[model samples]
Target: MFTGIVEELGEVTRVEPGDGVTRLVVRGPVVTGDAKHGDSIAVNGVCLTVVELSGDEFTVDVVPETLRRTSFDGVEPGRRVNLERAMAANGRFSGHIVQGHVDGTGTFLSRDHDGLTHFAYPPELSRYVVEKGSIAVDGISLTVAEVTRDEFAIALIPTTLAATTLGRNEPGDAVNLEVDVLAKYVEKLAAVHLPSAAVDNGGGEEDR
Candidate 1:
């Protein structure tokens, strides 16, 4: 598991497409400093296992399913991606629990002058987002400053803008999004006591 804390703004050095898997090589000195084979690394919020390591670069194979569900479907070389190694068992938990599993993708809609960035998320994810709740956008955990029926906003500090890929995001660019896993767990646990149809069908008033 990851903490949704970006340790390096890595560069994608190569993307080699194959029959069923795409090989991705990324350059991240900090994350690769002590990396080994089979270690998991969160690349742009998607947990990918390192299959090979060379110098400061590591390669991971991205399958079709991962590409379809993430912003990496047609990801190209030279793209800047957030990178974080799996959190150490003894490490401090600085950020919220992040699985590095992209639930879906969101669109970068706009950014206000004061760094209040707005994003349009899939409607299915709306119930999982709340004002002041934690959300992971491209692997960088951020607090939801506001939420609407179709979108949410985040007040990005200078540090976030400088440290993560959000700084370079364009208006129409797609971003990987992972809502708080605890919220999903709560919904699942609550479903047992609440009406089954409402929860099972995922069609009811927001659970809050």
Candidate 2:
């Protein structure tokens, strides 16, 4: 599990294609300081297991499914990605629980100088987003500022604008998005206990 708190900004050094898995070499000094084989590192909100280690650089294999589901399909050498080590057992949970599993990808629509950023997402994932709920964008935890039928916005603090990949992306760029897992659980539980609420299929009621 992760806390969606970015530890370092890492760069993809190389991408090697193989039969079953694609290898990605990334450079992260802080997150890889004591990293070893089989250790887990989150690259751009995707949980990747360290396959090999070389000083500050480590290799992780991406399956085809991951590429299809995440923005990693467009990842290339020299791309900067958000990096975070798995939360330690005693680590403080400053942010919400992040599985490093990107539910889907969203496109950056626009942002205001006042720090409100809007993103256009796939319509299918719209049910998962909620105003004021926690969401992870590129692995950084943020609260939903508002929601539209197919898009959502977040209020970014200066620290968020300066610390992670969100600072670098422009309009039309794809970003990895993971909605709160708790919300999904709630939906599933509600389906069993509150059939009327589940009949809405997690979109909730707009008019009521």
Candidate 3:
């Protein structure tokens, strides 16, 4: 798991395409300080494993499915990525739980000068978003400032504006998104209980 706290803004150093997987080498000095092979890292909310390590750089393989689900497929060598090492057991839980799993992608809509930023996502994902709930946008943990049937807004502070890839995102740019896991759990539980609930409410045949 990740904390959705971007430790540094890393640059993509290389992208080598294979038959079905792309190998990405990213330069993240801070995240690579103690990194080793087989460690997990979050690149723009996508959990990737470090398959190789070099000075100030680490490499991860992105499969076809991952590429299809994330914004990384559009990235090039000059692109910047939000990099975060997996959360340590002893680390402080400063942010909400972040699985580093990109549930879907959202398009950047606009950013107000007053710090409210908006993004448009697939309506199917709207059920997971709620006002004041947590969401990871391009790997940064943010609270939903507002929500609608089709989109949601979040307040980004100055630090966020300067620290991550979201700062450089333009309207229509794609960013990875991960909603709170608790919401998904709740949805699943609700679906499972609905039938029983209906039966309890006189919808079931009476027991002989």
Q: What lDDT would each prediction earn against the true structure?
A: 0.92, 0.88, 0.87
**Cα-based TM-score, every candidate:** 0.95, 0.92, 0.92
Cα lDDT tens digits for candidate 1, 1-208:
9998899899999999999999999999999999999999999999999999999999999988888888998989999999999999999999999988888899999998999999999998998999999999999989999999789999999899999999999999999999998998889878879886767545533211
Spell out the clash pairs found in candidate 2: none
Report the candidate with higher lDDT, 2 versus 3: 2
10 residues in a row with least lDDT, candidate 1: 199-208
For lDDT, candidate 1 versus 3, the one ahead is 1
lDDT of 2 by residue, 60-140 (tens): 999988888889886789999999999999999999999888888899988898899999988877878989989999888
> Across residues 1-208, which tens digit of lDDT does each residue of candidate 3 receive?
8888889999999999999889999999999999999999998888899999989999999998888888987679989999999999999887889888787889999998888999999887887899999999988899999999889999999998899988899999999989898877766656756876532232321111
Which candidate comes out best when scored by TM-score?
Answer: 1
How far residue 168's Cα lies from its native spot in candidate 3, in Å, is 0.8
Candidate 3 vs. truth: CA RMSD?
6.9
Question: What's model 2's TM-score?
Answer: 0.92
Backbone clashes in model 2: 0
